[model samples]
Target: MTGSLQPVLAGVVTALVGFASSFTVVLAGLRAVGATDTQASSGLLAVCVLSGASAVWLGLRHRLPISIAWSTPGAALLVATGPVAGGWPAAVGAFVVSGLLIVAAGLFPPLSRAVAAIPKPIAAAMLAGVLLPLCTAPVRALVEVPALAGPVVLVWLLLHRYARRWAVPGALAVAVVAIALTAPPARPGSAGLWPVLDPTVPSLSLSALVGLAVPLFLVTMAAQNVPGMAVLTGYGYRPPFGSALRVTGLASAVAAPVGGHAVNLAAITAALAAGPDAHPDPDRRWIASVTAGVGLALLGLGAGVATTLVLLSPPVLIEAVAGLALVGALAGALAAALAEPDAREAAVVTFVVTAAGVSLLGVGGAFWGLLAGGLMLLLFRRPRPATAPAPEDGGTVAGAATPRQPGRRPGRRGVPAGR
Candidate 1:
């Protein structure tokens, strides 16, 4: 019973963090991309439903801790992309394309391989740039609303230094308390329960396809799915990669017209369920993920309440909390980007160009950053020469004919003794 309880607790903890920690960023992203409050709520609910279901299904089917989640980076991409020429409807169309692309990639191993072929440094750098701005929310909010932001930052700093895992949620708690204590009470009727689906009839445009859809697909694939798989693999749990993509891709399409972006495998939250805290027996850990799914599904049904709390908060404060959540991720991405000497220059180029937020031909900086970085890699990457074959025990290089002894076989590394 104690053993069973541990996984259950871990699952609940993960779902709480998964839902509360980054939900604001998801809300902010939807709003930034022109979603109305109701539409945003609906979309959030939609994502929660799909992701939760996927988590449960995959976790149970494979007996692996296969947690699923919305692409926070993709949401960041949507935020950065802003509105499209055809507005929200066009953006929805782009989401559909991205969803289909993910589905297609799952169906075609070559496409998945191609996505995986993207250099790690460039991918890390691009992610860093996307997350960099969000991580600054705390600092920016400190200047704009010190009273509210100060306590939030202080809590985050303290928790980050000590508890680590609770840092973001703890800081968020502080922010909420600070707001409650300091801000004037909301006027009557300022908030209400509204969950309407303002469905968009998706319309495609060249600008949207190139600028939004393609970049969105790349961001979701490179930043979310690839690393996500790495996390799952790290946990000693392997699921069919193509199937996961298909599930998420189809889920994305289902959620798109309503408002949500994309759903994929969990990243930060994966560690919570995948690690030892979830269960001692790796075999039983699937229960943790399933538990997380059930919790998320319940939360999704109440997404309006979750979204409303965020809606009622000060935008800067929300940003600060969201940014605080991403600080660790941003730091990790930066370290990866600068780790390799051969990739450093290209990585830096990618980071700067992405951070600069430059757009060309309607496409966002992320695409351009990757393109520039890839080009830089071509010019700067040094090709390592083929390794020399090791000498055999017989004192000759591998595959070299050496002096033959009666019935003597090729020695170590397939080399015969003295020619």
Candidate 2:
């Protein structure tokens, strides 16, 4: 009980942070895609439940902080494709495709290798590019609603500098309290809190699926799954790739019918919990992730409460906190990407292209950033061969114990040949 308490507490905090960071993004994306409030709420519930379960299962197995969540990039892409496509049914097809792509990525070694080979500079550039819009959104909202947006921004800046770890959640708390105190009028029919859990029968259309599914799948794999693997490897834990992929895939498949679009490994949030604060023993930290899973599942059980919070929270606050909290990650990731010499130019190219905000074939800049960076490296660099040094005094300099020249025996230097 003594040793367990800290891990349990750490896990609970991890889940709350991860949920707070990701849940609003998913909800906003769904609403943009034309989901009714009830539909969007249900979708978010499915996402949290699935993420928590899979993260716990994986974390318990590896004893690593293996967090899982809905794909932020996929949600962003959905914002674009959802309205163009018919509705939720089309989105489901996309979800299935995303799962399939993730599975394929796990199974294919070459793809992983190629992805790993991407220069850090390029990856950083791409990440910065993706986050740019999110940063501006809050400022834009401030123009529309200064009372709510202005305070949230100030809170975000204060927390980011002084108490960054709590910035987003804290700002969100302040915004909620302020809104409650103000008691703004709610538009009729917008204020109800019920989210129907009755699963809708699955449907598919080839045209809609092809257009929507391909992009969604690509976004999930390139933006979320690839980076996720990078995060694990970067931190020195080599997960069983096949098992992780299968679990995420299975989780996504199960959750889709209930409205979750994609479920995958969490890079940023998992990294936070995996750090020293979560647990001293690397092996023990998984308990935190497992705790998060259980907590998420419990939260799912009270879907009404979760729904109410999301509904009641102002969009301006969500944007401000999310953007400011993520500012640190964006900086860190970009620095890593840019730190290396050989990869610098290509990484810059990837960053520029992605930041340009050009979307081709429904794929976002995150994917293109890596892709362009890879191309730049291929075009510019050539692999050099390992250098083999000549032996000194007939001894192999490359760690061979025996003398290379037969009769020229061993000696510290010119001490005549040894017997």
Candidate 3:
């Protein structure tokens, strides 16, 4: 009995951390795009339910740990772009387009290849740019509302130095308690005080389609889903990327009417549930991810309670917590963007352009930055040299690499006889 507890504990913590750390971002993103209070809460609820169900289904079907999450980068993209010209309805249309693109990427090899062909540095730069401004909310809240923000920052800093995984959760716990103590009685208007699906008929507009739809699809795939697959691979689980994308895309489409943007594989928290710490036996770790999915759905159903609690504080407090939550991701993106000298200049160009929040020709900065960076890479960087084969590779490498030079004699086409 005691032996089984570790996986369960890890699973619960993974779910808790995933929710507490990012839900505020999702809510803020919804509102940024002009989601009404009901619509925003509804979107949050739908995404939670869909994410949990997908995670459990994938975990059970593959017998592998798969933790699903809302697209944090997509949320940041929304934050950076602000509300579209036509408001929330148009944004919902773009959300639907993004989901369809995900589905297409999975179903069509060429589409998937196109997404894969995006340079890693450019993608990393765009993500870092999206996250940079969001990660500064803690500083703003500290200056604006020190009494409220000070304690949250202190607890976060202490826990970050000690128990890194628990840092954001600890800060969130303190915020919840503090808010509850100082908060006024429950408000009269919240989405029915329970999870309810309030669907909106989507309206398509050119600006929303180009600015929000395409970039949302790109960022969700590049920053979250792709790396999430890599993270699962790092944990020794080779996911069938095609099927994973397809299912999650379908889930996203189903949830979009209610404001859910994108639901995809989780990279950061996936490690928490997929790694050895979740369970000694690798085969049994799926339980943790499955448990996480169940936990996410439960949290979704109870979102009203948590939402009410969070709303009591000034909205900046929520942003502060969210900013703190995203600090690690921002750091990672920046590091990856500049990791190689060849791409460093191009990556910096991408980061600066995207962060500058420049929009042109009805397209957002993310797409332009990526386009500019890719162009720079093509012009400046040399193609990588072909790799040499290991000693064990035998004749396959010889045939591919040596291919009998045009003037060489047949008897000694490839390498010197003895040297």
Candidate 4:
């Protein structure tokens, strides 16, 4: 019973950590794109519900925590370019295009196979690169507001060293406590449950279609969905690609309007939920995602209340907690990406570039990190065959050693044995 209880606790913690870290970024992105209070909450709710449902559904079917989310890169692209072209409408259209591209990639096995073939180390490097900025945000905020951010940072460091698994929850608890200790009061506002229909209608514009839509599409496909699927596969789960894709696409289509821009597979957050510490069985860990989804939906439905809670914390406090929560995931990804032999070079390229935080032609560093690493692999490396040569014969060895073809047998070369 103690052993069983351990697994359950681990699973719950995994879900909590993954949910907390992933949602912070999503909320930040939504805010960056000008989502109103209700809209932002609703959009976050959509991410929670969809990500959890996908995780549960995939876990039940293939037994894995395949928690998905909106692509951070997509959001970065949106904030960088969506506003420049046509504002929210352009963002919505970009999401639609990106979702469709992801759907299309899932439907095409060749593309999936190609993405799957990328070296794991390189993927990890790219992931590390992409998440580095996110990880640093809290510290930067701390410099801005020490009174609130300082305590959270101190506790986070303590938990990270002594109670590794509790790191995220501990940091979050400290932030909540600090907020409770000293927060400015807020009065009731006119913002309510009203929905906006403006973002629902897609507007066709050359600037948005070329700049925002194209980059968003590419990022969702190469940077988000591809690595997400790899995380599931690495954990020995074969989630039905089509079902997950459809859910991500549908979620984005639904949320694109009212200021939600994009949703796809989560890489860093998904890793937190999919690893062994999450659950020993891996079959039941979907509970975490399920629970998170419910929480997210509630947050969306009660956007006002949720906003009140978020607003209660000093901005730096929230940022610090969010950054602290990601420390474990960042460490794990870096370790994994650097551990492999064949993937070392590719991974290094990815990590440095992604962490560089460069943006070019409306694309974020995440997308470019993957692109550069993949190109390096293609240009310099050959695929390592799964089997080696047979000892007696030159023929390749497979599942098991087979008798060499009569004519090709080493001992019988150039002549039939009995003739």
Candidate 4 differs from the real structure by a C-alpha RMSD in angstroms, to one decimal, of: 10.7
lDDT, ranked from best to worst: 3, 1, 2, 4
Residues 173-229 of candidate 2: C-alpha lDDT, one tens digit per residue: 777777676645563234245545635555665554655565465545545665564
Please provide the root mean square deviation of candidate 3 (C-alpha atoms, Å).
9.6
- Residues 256-355, candidate 1: write the lDDT tens digits: 9888788887877877887778887767888998999999877777667656667667788999998887776677778778888889999999988887
| Two-way lDDT contest, 3 vs 4, winner | 3
- Residue pairs with colliding backbones in model 3 are none
Whole-model lDDT values for every prediction: 0.76, 0.62, 0.80, 0.57
How many residue pairs clash (N, CA or C atoms closer than 3 angstroms) in each of the candidate models, in the order given?
6, 4, 0, 2
List CA RMSD, all candidates.
10.3, 11.5, 9.6, 10.7
Write model 4 residue lDDT over 238-345, tens digit each, in one string: 545666766677676666665556666666555555555555555655554444444444334544444455656666566566556555546756776778677678
Better of 1 and 4 by lDDT: 1
Summing lDDT over every window of 10 consecutive residues in candidate 3, give the lowest-scoring window.
Answer: 393-402
lDDT tens digits, residue span 106-190, model 3 = 7886786687667667888888888877888999999988888899999999999999888998998888877777777655446
Cα error, candidate 4, residue 87 (Å): 1.8
Clashes of 3: 0
User: In model 2, what lDDT does residue 139 have?
Assistant: 78
* RMSD value for candidate 2: 11.5
